[model samples]
Target: MAGDKAVSTVSKPVMRGLLNSSIKRNLTVALTLAAISGVAFKQLVGNERKRKYAEFYRNYDAEKEFEEMRKKGLFQSC
Candidate 1:
Protein backbone atom coordinates (compact mmCIF):
# COMPACT_ATOMS: atom_id res chain seq x y z
CA MET A 1 0.00 0.00 0.00
CA ALA A 2 2.90 2.44 0.62
CA GLY A 3 4.03 2.13 -3.00
CA ASP A 4 0.69 3.51 -4.30
CA LYS A 5 1.47 7.20 -3.31
CA ALA A 6 2.49 9.66 -6.09
CA VAL A 7 5.46 12.08 -5.74
CA SER A 8 5.75 15.49 -7.52
CA THR A 9 8.68 17.99 -7.84
CA VAL A 10 8.36 21.58 -6.70
CA SER A 11 9.58 24.39 -9.02
CA LYS A 12 10.34 28.05 -7.92
CA PRO A 13 9.94 30.12 -11.12
CA VAL A 14 7.84 32.76 -9.28
CA MET A 15 10.55 33.37 -6.72
CA ARG A 16 13.19 33.68 -9.44
CA GLY A 17 11.08 36.21 -11.38
CA LEU A 18 10.31 38.23 -8.24
CA LEU A 19 13.95 38.41 -7.14
CA ASN A 20 15.14 39.40 -10.64
CA SER A 21 12.57 42.20 -10.94
CA SER A 22 13.24 43.47 -7.41
CA ILE A 23 16.97 43.75 -8.02
CA LYS A 24 16.47 45.56 -11.30
CA ARG A 25 13.97 48.02 -9.77
CA ASN A 26 16.17 48.78 -6.79
CA LEU A 27 19.27 49.32 -8.95
CA THR A 28 17.43 51.66 -11.32
CA VAL A 29 16.02 53.69 -8.42
CA ALA A 30 19.45 54.02 -6.74
CA LEU A 31 21.18 55.08 -9.96
CA THR A 32 18.46 57.66 -10.73
CA LEU A 33 18.72 59.18 -7.23
CA ALA A 34 22.52 59.33 -7.40
CA ALA A 35 22.43 61.07 -10.76
CA ILE A 36 19.90 63.66 -9.56
CA SER A 37 21.87 64.39 -6.38
CA GLY A 38 25.10 64.71 -8.36
CA VAL A 39 23.55 67.26 -10.71
CA ALA A 40 22.11 69.25 -7.80
CA PHE A 41 25.44 69.32 -5.99
CA LYS A 42 27.39 70.46 -9.06
CA GLN A 43 24.95 73.04 -10.45
CA LEU A 44 22.69 74.28 -7.66
CA VAL A 45 24.73 73.93 -4.48
CA GLY A 46 27.81 75.90 -5.75
CA ASN A 47 31.19 76.15 -3.99
CA GLU A 48 32.20 76.31 -0.32
CA ARG A 49 34.36 78.99 1.36
CA LYS A 50 36.14 78.76 4.75
CA ARG A 51 37.39 81.91 6.51
CA LYS A 52 38.81 82.54 9.96
CA TYR A 53 37.19 85.27 12.11
CA ALA A 54 40.18 85.21 14.53
CA GLU A 55 42.19 87.12 11.89
CA PHE A 56 40.23 90.23 12.89
CA TYR A 57 42.36 90.32 16.03
CA ARG A 58 45.33 91.23 13.83
CA ASN A 59 43.72 94.62 13.09
CA TYR A 60 43.11 95.61 16.75
CA ASP A 61 45.04 98.46 18.44
CA ALA A 62 45.81 96.76 21.74
CA GLU A 63 48.54 99.13 23.00
CA LYS A 64 46.63 102.32 22.14
CA GLU A 65 43.46 101.02 23.75
CA PHE A 66 45.39 100.03 26.86
CA GLU A 67 47.02 103.52 27.10
CA GLU A 68 43.58 105.18 26.67
CA MET A 69 42.03 102.93 29.30
CA ARG A 70 44.93 103.65 31.69
CA LYS A 71 44.67 107.40 31.17
CA LYS A 72 40.89 107.28 31.80
CA GLY A 73 41.51 105.38 35.07
CA LEU A 74 39.37 102.48 33.81
CA PHE A 75 41.73 99.90 35.43
CA GLN A 76 41.43 99.41 39.18
CA SER A 77 44.93 97.87 39.63
CA CYS A 78 46.70 100.42 37.41
Candidate 2:
Protein backbone atom coordinates (compact mmCIF):
# COMPACT_ATOMS: atom_id res chain seq x y z
CA MET A 1 0.00 0.00 0.00
CA ALA A 2 2.75 2.48 0.89
CA GLY A 3 4.65 1.57 -2.27
CA ASP A 4 1.60 2.20 -4.39
CA LYS A 5 1.08 5.55 -2.69
CA ALA A 6 4.69 6.59 -3.37
CA VAL A 7 4.40 5.62 -7.03
CA SER A 8 1.21 7.60 -7.40
CA THR A 9 2.74 10.63 -5.79
CA VAL A 10 5.84 10.53 -7.98
CA SER A 11 3.80 9.96 -11.14
CA LYS A 12 1.62 12.98 -10.44
CA PRO A 13 4.59 15.36 -10.40
CA VAL A 14 6.15 13.73 -13.44
CA MET A 15 2.92 14.03 -15.37
CA ARG A 16 2.58 17.64 -14.30
CA GLY A 17 6.07 18.45 -15.54
CA LEU A 18 5.41 16.83 -18.90
CA LEU A 19 2.14 18.68 -19.31
CA ASN A 20 3.74 22.00 -18.40
CA SER A 21 6.50 21.57 -20.97
CA SER A 22 4.01 20.62 -23.66
CA ILE A 23 1.83 23.62 -22.87
CA LYS A 24 4.81 25.97 -22.97
CA ARG A 25 5.90 24.64 -26.37
CA ASN A 26 2.41 24.96 -27.77
CA LEU A 27 2.05 28.51 -26.43
CA THR A 28 5.34 29.53 -28.01
CA VAL A 29 4.27 28.18 -31.39
CA ALA A 30 0.90 29.91 -31.18
CA LEU A 31 2.45 33.25 -30.33
CA THR A 32 4.99 32.94 -33.13
CA LEU A 33 2.29 32.17 -35.71
CA ALA A 34 0.17 35.06 -34.45
CA ALA A 35 3.07 37.47 -34.79
CA ILE A 36 3.87 36.29 -38.31
CA SER A 37 0.25 36.61 -39.37
CA GLY A 38 0.00 40.08 -37.87
CA VAL A 39 3.02 41.26 -39.80
CA ALA A 40 1.73 39.69 -42.99
CA PHE A 41 -1.64 41.36 -42.52
CA LYS A 42 0.02 44.71 -41.95
CA GLN A 43 2.06 44.36 -45.12
CA LEU A 44 -0.98 43.37 -47.14
CA VAL A 45 -2.97 46.33 -45.85
CA GLY A 46 -0.13 48.73 -46.55
CA ASN A 47 0.25 47.42 -50.07
CA GLU A 48 -3.48 47.66 -50.70
CA ARG A 49 -3.59 51.25 -49.49
CA LYS A 50 -0.68 52.12 -51.72
CA ARG A 51 -2.42 50.52 -54.69
CA LYS A 52 -5.63 52.45 -53.97
CA TYR A 53 -3.74 55.71 -53.66
CA ALA A 54 -2.01 55.16 -56.97
CA GLU A 55 -5.25 54.23 -58.63
CA PHE A 56 -6.92 57.36 -57.34
CA TYR A 57 -4.17 59.62 -58.70
CA ARG A 58 -3.63 57.69 -61.91
CA ASN A 59 -5.60 60.20 -63.98
CA TYR A 60 -5.88 63.06 -61.54
CA ASP A 61 -5.35 66.64 -62.69
CA ALA A 62 -4.14 68.61 -59.69
CA GLU A 63 -3.79 71.98 -61.47
CA LYS A 64 -7.27 71.69 -62.98
CA GLU A 65 -8.76 70.88 -59.57
CA PHE A 66 -6.94 73.84 -58.07
CA GLU A 67 -8.43 76.10 -60.74
CA GLU A 68 -11.88 74.74 -60.04
CA MET A 69 -11.45 75.35 -56.35
CA ARG A 70 -10.34 78.93 -57.11
CA LYS A 71 -13.34 79.48 -59.33
CA LYS A 72 -15.59 78.22 -56.56
CA GLY A 73 -14.00 80.81 -54.19
CA LEU A 74 -12.72 77.98 -52.02
CA PHE A 75 -9.22 79.45 -52.21
CA GLN A 76 -8.14 82.98 -51.37
CA SER A 77 -5.26 84.51 -53.30
CA CYS A 78 -2.96 87.12 -51.80
Candidate 3:
Protein backbone atom coordinates (compact mmCIF):
# COMPACT_ATOMS: atom_id res chain seq x y z
CA MET A 1 0.00 0.00 0.00
CA ALA A 2 2.97 2.33 0.26
CA GLY A 3 2.89 2.93 -3.51
CA ASP A 4 -0.87 3.66 -3.50
CA LYS A 5 -1.80 7.31 -3.56
CA ALA A 6 -4.94 9.45 -3.95
CA VAL A 7 -5.42 12.48 -6.20
CA SER A 8 -8.33 14.92 -6.61
CA THR A 9 -9.99 15.09 -10.04
CA VAL A 10 -10.34 18.86 -9.72
CA SER A 11 -7.60 21.13 -8.36
CA LYS A 12 -7.94 24.28 -6.22
CA PRO A 13 -7.11 26.71 -9.02
CA VAL A 14 -9.67 25.19 -11.38
CA MET A 15 -12.30 25.25 -8.66
CA ARG A 16 -11.51 28.88 -7.90
CA GLY A 17 -11.80 29.81 -11.57
CA LEU A 18 -15.16 28.08 -11.89
CA LEU A 19 -16.44 29.74 -8.72
CA ASN A 20 -15.32 33.19 -9.91
CA SER A 21 -16.96 32.71 -13.28
CA SER A 22 -20.23 31.67 -11.66
CA ILE A 23 -20.18 34.67 -9.31
CA LYS A 24 -19.53 37.04 -12.20
CA ARG A 25 -22.39 35.64 -14.22
CA ASN A 26 -24.83 35.83 -11.30
CA LEU A 27 -23.76 39.37 -10.41
CA THR A 28 -24.23 40.57 -13.96
CA VAL A 29 -27.72 39.04 -14.15
CA ALA A 30 -28.75 40.48 -10.77
CA LEU A 31 -27.53 43.96 -11.61
CA THR A 32 -29.25 43.96 -14.98
CA LEU A 33 -32.58 42.85 -13.51
CA ALA A 34 -32.31 45.34 -10.66
CA ALA A 35 -31.68 48.20 -13.05
CA ILE A 36 -34.61 47.20 -15.26
CA SER A 37 -36.92 46.89 -12.25
CA GLY A 38 -35.88 50.29 -10.97
CA VAL A 39 -36.62 51.91 -14.31
CA ALA A 40 -40.00 50.18 -14.53
CA PHE A 41 -40.89 51.24 -10.98
CA LYS A 42 -40.09 54.86 -11.76
CA GLN A 43 -42.32 54.78 -14.82
CA LEU A 44 -45.15 53.29 -12.78
CA VAL A 45 -44.73 55.97 -10.13
CA GLY A 46 -44.75 58.74 -12.74
CA ASN A 47 -47.94 57.41 -14.27
CA GLU A 48 -49.56 57.20 -10.85
CA ARG A 49 -48.57 60.80 -10.09
CA LYS A 50 -50.18 61.98 -13.33
CA ARG A 51 -53.37 60.06 -12.53
CA LYS A 52 -53.50 61.53 -9.02
CA TYR A 53 -52.97 65.05 -10.37
CA ALA A 54 -55.85 64.59 -12.77
CA GLU A 55 -58.07 63.32 -9.99
CA PHE A 56 -57.18 66.28 -7.76
CA TYR A 57 -57.93 68.80 -10.49
CA ARG A 58 -61.19 67.13 -11.56
CA ASN A 59 -63.24 69.19 -9.06
CA TYR A 60 -60.64 71.76 -8.09
CA ASP A 61 -60.91 75.57 -8.26
CA ALA A 62 -57.86 77.45 -6.97
CA GLU A 63 -59.89 80.43 -5.72
CA LYS A 64 -62.36 78.23 -3.83
CA GLU A 65 -59.54 76.23 -2.22
CA PHE A 66 -57.82 79.42 -1.08
CA GLU A 67 -61.05 80.81 0.27
CA GLU A 68 -61.66 77.65 2.28
CA MET A 69 -58.14 77.87 3.73
CA ARG A 70 -58.76 81.47 4.67
CA LYS A 71 -61.94 80.50 6.44
CA LYS A 72 -59.97 77.93 8.43
CA GLY A 73 -57.53 80.70 9.60
CA LEU A 74 -54.66 78.91 7.93
CA PHE A 75 -53.01 82.11 6.60
CA GLN A 76 -50.82 84.42 8.63
CA SER A 77 -52.08 88.00 9.27
CA CYS A 78 -49.08 89.61 7.63
Candidate 4:
Protein backbone atom coordinates (compact mmCIF):
# COMPACT_ATOMS: atom_id res chain seq x y z
CA MET A 1 0.00 0.00 0.00
CA ALA A 2 2.86 2.40 0.84
CA GLY A 3 4.55 1.70 -2.46
CA ASP A 4 1.33 2.27 -4.33
CA LYS A 5 0.77 5.58 -2.54
CA ALA A 6 4.30 6.75 -3.38
CA VAL A 7 3.83 5.94 -7.10
CA SER A 8 0.54 7.77 -7.26
CA THR A 9 2.01 10.88 -5.60
CA VAL A 10 4.89 10.99 -8.07
CA SER A 11 2.62 10.53 -11.07
CA LYS A 12 0.25 13.33 -9.97
CA PRO A 13 3.03 15.92 -9.78
CA VAL A 14 4.42 14.79 -13.15
CA MET A 15 1.01 15.10 -14.75
CA ARG A 16 0.51 18.56 -13.28
CA GLY A 17 3.90 19.68 -14.53
CA LEU A 18 3.10 18.45 -18.02
CA LEU A 19 -0.18 20.29 -17.99
CA ASN A 20 1.54 23.53 -16.90
CA SER A 21 4.18 23.24 -19.57
CA SER A 22 1.56 22.66 -22.24
CA ILE A 23 -0.31 25.78 -21.14
CA LYS A 24 2.84 27.88 -21.25
CA ARG A 25 3.76 26.58 -24.71
CA ASN A 26 0.31 27.34 -26.06
CA LEU A 27 0.35 30.85 -24.62
CA THR A 28 3.71 31.58 -26.18
CA VAL A 29 2.53 30.46 -29.60
CA ALA A 30 -0.62 32.58 -29.32
CA LEU A 31 1.37 35.72 -28.43
CA THR A 32 3.78 35.16 -31.31
CA LEU A 33 0.91 34.80 -33.76
CA ALA A 34 -0.73 37.96 -32.52
CA ALA A 35 2.49 39.94 -32.94
CA ILE A 36 2.97 38.66 -36.46
CA SER A 37 -0.59 39.51 -37.41
CA GLY A 38 -0.21 43.03 -36.04
CA VAL A 39 2.93 43.63 -38.11
CA ALA A 40 1.23 42.37 -41.25
CA PHE A 41 -1.73 44.61 -40.66
CA LYS A 42 0.51 47.63 -40.23
CA GLN A 43 2.38 46.88 -43.42
CA LEU A 44 -0.86 46.51 -45.35
CA VAL A 45 -2.08 49.86 -44.11
CA GLY A 46 1.20 51.55 -45.08
CA ASN A 47 1.04 50.07 -48.57
CA GLU A 48 -2.53 51.24 -49.01
CA ARG A 49 -1.59 54.76 -47.98
CA LYS A 50 1.29 54.78 -50.45
CA ARG A 51 -1.00 53.57 -53.21
CA LYS A 52 -3.52 56.31 -52.45
CA TYR A 53 -0.86 59.01 -52.49
CA ALA A 54 0.50 57.78 -55.82
CA GLU A 55 -2.97 57.79 -57.34
CA PHE A 56 -3.61 61.29 -56.07
CA TYR A 57 -0.40 62.58 -57.63
CA ARG A 58 -1.16 60.86 -60.92
CA ASN A 59 -4.62 62.42 -61.10
CA TYR A 60 -3.29 65.82 -60.14
CA ASP A 61 -0.72 65.74 -62.91
CA ALA A 62 -3.30 64.73 -65.48
CA GLU A 63 -5.56 67.59 -64.45
CA LYS A 64 -2.71 70.08 -64.66
CA GLU A 65 -1.83 68.90 -68.17
CA PHE A 66 -5.41 69.15 -69.25
CA GLU A 67 -5.58 72.76 -68.03
CA GLU A 68 -2.41 73.68 -69.89
CA MET A 69 -3.72 72.15 -73.09
CA ARG A 70 -6.97 74.07 -72.73
CA LYS A 71 -5.08 77.36 -72.38
CA LYS A 72 -3.08 76.52 -75.52
CA GLY A 73 -6.35 75.95 -77.49
CA LEU A 74 -5.47 72.30 -78.23
CA PHE A 75 -9.05 71.33 -77.32
CA GLN A 76 -11.73 73.55 -78.80
CA SER A 77 -14.24 74.83 -76.25
CA CYS A 78 -17.73 73.92 -77.41
lDDT of all the models against the reference? 0.77, 0.86, 0.86, 0.84
Model 4 per-residue lDDT tens digits across residues 1-78: 768866744344566579889999999999999999999987999788999999988778777788888888898661
Q: lDDT of candidate 1?
A: 0.77
Against the hidden reference, what TM-scores do the models get?
A: 0.39, 0.56, 0.56, 0.43
Please give the distance, in angstroms, between residue 3's alpha carbon in candidate 2 and its true position after superposition.
Answer: 13
RMSD of each: 11.7, 5.5, 5.2, 7.7
Shift of residue 63 alpha carbon in model 1, Å: 28
User: What is the Å distance of residue 38 in model 4 from its true position?
Assistant: 0.4
Q: Candidate 4: minimum summed lDDT over ten consecutive residues — where?
A: 7-16
Which TM-score value belongs to model 3? 0.56
Candidate 2 matches the true fold with a TM-score of 0.56
lDDT of 3 by residue, 1-78 (tens): 644556436555666479889999999999999999999987899788988999999978999988999999999981
Residue 57 alpha-carbon offset, candidate 4, angstroms: 9.7
Write the residue-wise lDDT of candidate 1 on 1-78 in tens digits.
655566656775676579889999999999999999998776654432112334556667899899999999999999
